[model samples]
Target: IEERAADASTPRAGPIPPSQRSDMVGSAEGVTEMAFDASVLRERDFRDTRRRIQLLARLPDIVAGSVDDEELLVRVSDTLLRATPSASAVAIVRANVPEPMGAGDEKPSNEHPSKMKVLHYDCRENGAQQHSVSSRLVTTALQRRESVLHLWETERNGGIEFTAAENVDWAFCVPLRSEACAGWAIYVAGSRALGSNWKELADDSATLADRLGDDVKFAEVVGSLISGIRQTSHFQQRHLAMRRFFAPVVLDALSGQDPQSWLQPRQCDLSVMFCDLRGFSRTSEMQSDQLLLLLEQVSAALGVMTRHILDTGGVIGDFHGDAAMGFWGWPIELQLSDPHSDLSASAHVVASVLAAARAAAGIRMDYAMGQTEFRCGIGIASGSAVAGRIGTVDQVKVTAFGPVVNLASRLEGLTKHFGVEVLMDHASASALQAWLGQDEFTEEPSPFRLRKLGRVRVAGMKIPVDVYQLVVPSGGTQDLTDSQIDAYEQGWDEFAKGDWDSAYQRLLELPAWDRPKDVLLRLILQHHRIAPSGWEGVLDFPK
Candidate 1:
């Protein structure tokens, strides 16, 4: 066995072989001629070059809004091959990994196959590699980033080697990054048997790669833009919700309602109250930051009061900076069996509102100016009035438009004239008399004065309206009356008739003592029905 092995390794010397000499000479001449031809060929085929450019230019427009990655790859590969006829096969690897060398161990050749082969290699994993061979001349072009060209020759060992093996011949690998999570690598292989110049073909392949990359970049930008748009939409939605929570009245105006019809022509019984902070303007002017702090405290106090009012079934009409207006009977009504019952409810509402305002004022004074104290004046009235959406479409407001609202404001102003924290008109005072508990008022009552105008008439009266200043603590009052309860039920009936204007007017007229405002909202809601299209439902007013 040792002797045999030695003989196998030993070189065998023989006589001059004519056949081998002829073959060697012929191959050398052929290679030299081929090299000359390759050198003379230009960088790229002019016709094919133009076609590829045109195809690449269209890629961006085609790929937009497309979700199918495979379809995108296939279309891109087809465009590339058509643009450059020398390309024997195009393989697109849509993954981060290196591409596999062959299709299932099938050895690739430098000769062009009978048909062009296009393969889609899906490499979902991180490391996937792919390899393909086209014409030998083009193979040498696969070096650096873009293009390569090559020439193949068979050796005595029955193995094949490429010309200019030092540099990769005939290969183009272009990396692609998209908006999606994965990246792609496009591979184009040239054939040596086709007898084409690989250098020119390689350059063309490089150009193709660049064009495809641009397409990928465009797609990525589009995806990012879409994401940004969605984020903006979400932010807008949240903003609207916050606005609605803070200002329900403002929101209602924007929600589409006819201002003139809703506000101008309707009558209902209602309880109205006006509250204003004392010395707020002067304090705010002195220190703006301090004022803001004061405002925040005031807002918190108002929030608590508003919640209380809502819990007791009252509707807040409007708030103007430091001032706020609330109503009981306009939008809803209460059922009051007795006149005294009506008076009791009004007393409670007025007391509750004034107490809340004072609490808020005190808090603001304590936090903003330790020694400084704050106070608020409130006025209460019960009467018939109209309230609804008012103003032009571009600038609309939900407002109570009636003498009752004016009277309430006038009474609030009278708080300064009368030198008292709270004052109620004779109507409201009478309605709330029972609910005032043990609190008393001075018998020598001054006339209720009006702002701009001097005096005004009130409901259920034959003489001038007499106003009373309640001598109650910051926060004390009685429950509602039976007549006020009757008023709430009547107000609700009007609200259900799709007559918000009349409902509000009649509800306001019911008596402050009725606690008409506290129970009015609930009654209105109970009796009122909203149509599917959001219109107010018809009311069956009881006779």
Candidate 2:
């Protein structure tokens, strides 16, 4: 019966197939002589044909409203009931399907067929009966995977009527099957004798069910795609927020790794650089108009330094008044325990800061009584430290915590005492030396010149640390000459060997602008008289 109903459907461009049409007409040839009235059949056919036209006109609306699944299903149920002749109730139930099968999969078991969730539309006074009958019809249609029609007459109070639900005498249950969904659509109508139109009604109901199934499946697919799109959009927004707080390398690593794990504190080897304006405090005491101009110049200088740091894949940790702190090898394993990477990063940072310092020194503002020679100091240190995010949720910062951070800051402060513009610890200096040693062209003059200073124990440390000055030749702005560097090194060797008088004479032979020579002169004057015992020239800061 289901197959015949399916075959009855013809393309809108042509009439039904001749053979099936002839068979249907021949089966109803003797309708007038049957037990049931023929007029009832004729009237049913007329009404069903009209209702089908109405349903077809509204089919597009039902399909187009598929963005909202619940709304679309409700409208579909209502339309089915309207098109079904004399229907007292209608129900639509979606099938519960397991995962899609693969080629090698065996047939799935139906022992625990999914429960039916029926959407019922009750037109009669009895809602409970409508629901109960709908459930049974849905289950039957799913079990058979076909259309099921039942007709019965109940003798109640001398009148024949169906007694199962609202005295319905006829029930039509058809499975809604499509590539995207499986379900059932059930229609129940009151008792009426139909001599010939019963078969036609069943065929029409089956056709409608099949076509509607495809539409519903398409709607479901569209809805699922929309949901997935929304979820992806949300994830992208969160990723952008993470980018705001973390460096690009860290963000890339976190993109593949877990963000929660990356946020936790960990011990890592890092290179930290601290840069501060040398005379910002004194400059700040000037009149507001002049102070504003000076600050603007300072900002421009920092911008240049910032580009250098970022270009070398460094992360700007934070900014203090007139100063900036940045670091490398964090959030992700940037340097990866490689000394060369640390040295390269530190060298770049020092070069950038020195360039900014040089630019600041030439600031010519009318308010400057003349050209204001602004000087800056950059201090770099490389070692292991604890790195991660810190502070409350509302105001968090990504930075490192350890002696490396402290020593870097202290080194920046010492740049003034040593009369040098750029200073770094032994680790950075050694790494730079190793990196420079790899250079094949020794005659071309190395890109950077490294000068070792005497050992010094800063205010907070128990052991002394060796410091070095980094100098880069600006564009035609002549750095230390080779001869001058040689002389300074020889003098420094003398000073380290405890020959203060010889060191002073050798240092005096170099240019007076040399910062190391200035530092050695100061040290000699301070310790010439009170010679402390076992003093190996390790300068200690006063508490």
Candidate 3:
């Protein structure tokens, strides 16, 4: 056997057969013919020229075959045997060794055992009895990093002779290079049925073997790209989950910080808001069998509230039976990024919650025909609280814990008693006041109208807390008329000073639309009761 490069431009011994002239194997039917650069070539050059033509006929199949890798390699080996005619069997082996598996300072050696598997082949009757080439020779060819050949002959006395094998008596091994796997392919050819020209067949086989190496590399690259895309998709899903529960500015900061450190439990200054639908229990009981209808009405009302809250950069914490809890200024710093932004964040929280409450109160649904419109009450508080993750590992929830949250809930409950839609504790009320008092805010007419409700010590609290009532208009910033504001404050001052007779007469003189009539009415009823001896105008509500 012999090995050498096949000249690319050469004429075949005869016209290529119709069966082998398919487009799959590359069409040679066109008119262009190659022109040789040299004149007067030698005998060996002529043989190389002929060998090239035969190999070129099979080029298209190897490069663009529709079949899989195994089938493509089998076709290459079978084509080589067909070209030789003297060979009757073939095998296409795949390399299977791990690449660079050693530890530090360890180097690989040539003596390492070769890992290989047969990809495809054609075995003839006599060829099945013995291997045309031994595995050791295959390893030796790989170590040498090139093609090597061996030939033997049967002696007249029935003993084998160590002579160069002719067309029917040779074995050859060719290395197929690839970085994807640390091994080489072995093509074993066997037979004894022809005149000669074994050297040309060996040369053609070596050429096809090299191209096969490239095919393996291409597969590896495709596999790697798919893996990378899948990993990116997973990260995107996690990013979306976090975004759903936090604001964009928070996420921006979290991207650079370590989650393990920030997620630990700690105290943080935050503003918490709680909103609940008033008389929802009675409403649900009335629409008992039509739960779906109730859900549609409630969802429509809540959807508006949710959108406004999210727009204001508030993180929704939990959605209990008929209420939603939300907060701001935790999991990250709440520095004033802009001039108005200092109080704007808290102001937004109040405005959004009030807007939602008003919307819920005014919603009219077809399913609730003849029923009264739904109304919601909202309460907001600002203070320091312990904030962190809670629940089991698999289903953890991020939430805030402390009196700040509890007070917000209590304030929501007081909305019904005060006959108001929205209420807030001192911290949040102060922030709103600061922004509303600004020139920018005063010039535009504030989005909210504030009323100072008298101090009261709520249940479970030692200190009396100052509360305020907020009136949010339906569309834009439109404060109440002067008469409406004057009437409520005038009546409140007299009531708080314990002058029951004057307070009763002042509230009685104001028009019904001057303010919420219930506030004055409730005060008149309480006015007749005897107060505790040390009362400093603070109402004691133990419930």
Winning candidate number (TM-score):
3
Stretches of candidate 1 exceeding 4 Å from the true structure: 1-265, 289-291, 335-373, 434-464, 474-543
- For model 2 the TM-score comes to 0.53
Quantify all predictions' global Cα lDDT against the true fold. Answer: 0.44, 0.56, 0.55
lDDT tens per residue, model 1, 26-130? 122112101111222222233445544565467566544344556655555555555444445566543323222343633222332233333373321225233
**For model 1, where is the 10-residue window of minimal lDDT?**
1-10
Question: What C-alpha lDDT, on a 0 to 100 scale, does residue 514 get in candidate 3?
Answer: 36
lDDT (10s digit) by residue, model 2, range 1-543 = 111111111101112233433112111110100011123222333334555556566676664556555665566556655554445566555555444335564432223236666654545345445534434334444454444444333332343322433545445555544423445344344433222344343333233323233323332233333334433454667678755445565566667665567877788878788887766777767645687788786686565456556555566777887887777777665442346454444444343333433433333221144434355778888888887776786987777789988888888888888777678899877766766666453667676777776788998888899988777554443467878878887887778778878888889998766666887788787888233568677877645
Candidate 2 deviant stretches above 4 angstroms:
1-254, 287-296, 335-374, 392-394, 439-443, 475-478, 527-530
Candidates ranked by lDDT, best first?
2, 3, 1
Give me candidate 3's TM-score against the actual structure. 0.54
| Best candidate according to lDDT | 2
Judge candidate 2 at residue 107 and give its lDDT: 31
Candidate numbers sorted by TM-score from highest down: 3, 2, 1
**Listing every candidate in turn, what is its Cα RMSD in Å to the true structure after a full C-alpha superposition?**
24.8, 15.4, 15.6
Better of 1 and 2 by lDDT: 2
* Candidate number with the higher lDDT (1 or 3): 3
